[model samples]
Target: MNAKKEPSIWQGFKAFLMRGNVVDLAVAVVIGAAFTNIVNSVVKGLINPLVGAIGTQNLDHYSSCLSSSCKGDQGIHLMWGSVLGATLSFVITAAVVYFLMVLPMAKYLARVEARRKAREGTHEIIEVTELEVLKEIRDALIAQRGSVHDER
Candidate 1:
């Protein structure tokens, strides 16, 4: 009797963690967290101050009262400035990642692919030339044998 054994939970978990994609994703997440700090700092340190020159120091404080009298712990306050600041941060992060990481990686991969194709093309040409040379050799051998038979 043949019994198929399913992987144990721990084995399955280990396999999942050992996958290349899983490790890559984990690395990306950690890098993204660190990158977020830089982006946040840029927003807070540079953008906030430049914006603060016009109004409040912090964008989070910029809001509007939906209802009358937005007093302590009361009324509907629309925090539009916070949203703007977050949006700016997201744009900056995306631009930095795209230009620095994604674009360069894509270009490098493209170059690698082009080089691989060129190598394959050269290999194919060599193969075709070899085949042609082999055919010529076979034809010459056949001619030599025919002439020898004629002399006999």
Candidate 2:
């Protein structure tokens, strides 16, 4: 009797690490972190300064006190400016990722799929021709066998 051996833990771990999804996720995380820095810089350097020209230099400073005093967390302070800044960062990041990465990747994948299908179509035609040749060979062999039997 033959028994199949199960893979070792190390082998399984290596396979998991080598998977395309794991590599893709790692790349995505790195790119996301880098993209975050760019978005933060845009908000802090460009957007904040433009907003500052109208009111304050930092959007985080723009808050409203719900109570009489908002000093040192004494009262309810609605920090709308920080929320605005975060929202802006998120919107910009999403837009950039969609337009630059997601859109291009989608188009590229479509092209690759089209090429694959085209190759498969050509392979199918070749297979059909091979089948026809095989059928003709089989028929010729049967005919020759019959002629030999008739001569006997």
Candidate 3:
């Protein structure tokens, strides 16, 4: 007897790539890579020089010495500069993402949610009022009818 063959892993991967979520992720990755250059430029070109312009002249490089042999010896590794650069990059990226994308998206979503809540609130009010009116009508109908004896 002949059996149907299972699809290969590569074929499955290809199908996954074709899915909307996968495609969107791929696009986002490319965009993120492109955005990296802009953020990097801001950090390197603008922030680094601004820091350098400050009294310390490369503020990142300026650090207090703390060593065993020479209690106040300057460290060979300028670790603070690297740290400052990283911090600057983090701040810039966070600011850009917040101002450019996250804040606006949040406001838009808030507006949409508020509109939905308004619609739902109106519907709920109408439903509750109708239910109350129906209850009143039902009680009137019962009152109009003579009370029946309860059969045990």
Candidate 4:
């Protein structure tokens, strides 16, 4: 009798970590973390200052008081400014990633696919033409053999 050995836990874990998607995901996470700093800096340095021209430079300070006697940590303070700041950061990040990276990559892939299809189409046309020529040659040979037999 023959038996197959099961994979050890260490081998299984190694295999999982060595997968292409796992490595790609890890890289994406690291890059995303680095990209986040850039986005945050842009928002704080540029966006906040521009918005500050209208009101406060810091969006976190902008808020509305709900309670009647509202003081420092006394009443209901709705920190809408922070929310707006976060929303802006997210928007900016998404726009940068989409325009700078995703959009260009998509366009490049599309062009490559189009070129590949064109090449395949040309090959198919050539193959069909060759087949047709072969069929004509076969018919001519057959006709010649019949004529030769008749002459005999």
**Candidate 4 global TM-score:** 0.90
Q: Against the true structure, candidate 3 has what lDDT?
A: 0.79
The sequence of per-residue lDDT tens digits that candidate 4 reaches over residues 1-152 is: 77899999999999999999999999989999999999999999999999999999999999999999888989999999999999999999999999999999999999999999999999999999999999999999999999999999
Regions of candidate 3 where Cα sits further than 4 Å from its true position: 1-24, 55-76, 147-152
TM-score of each: 0.85, 0.70, 0.67, 0.90
Candidate structures ordered by TM-score, highest first? 4, 1, 2, 3
Leading candidate by lDDT:
4
Error of 3 at 113 (Å): 1.1
Q: Give the Cα error of residue 56 in candidate 4, in Å.
A: 0.5
* lDDT for 80 (candidate 3): 73
Better of 1 and 2 by TM-score: 1
**Per-residue lDDT of candidate 3, residues 1-152 (tens digit):** 89999999999999988999998899889988888899988876777677777644454566544553433344544457667777877888889989998999999999999999999999999999999999999998786664553332
RMSD of 3: 5.8
Model 4's lDDT to the true fold? 0.97
The full ranking of all candidates by lDDT, starting with the best, is 4, 1, 2, 3
By TM-score, is 2 or 3 better? 2
How high is the lDDT of residue 125 in model 1? 100
Per-residue alpha-carbon lDDT of candidate 1 for residues 1-152, written as tens digits (9 for 90 to 100): 89999999999999999999999999999999999999999998999999999998799988989998889769999999989998999999999999999999999999999999999999999999999999999999999999999999
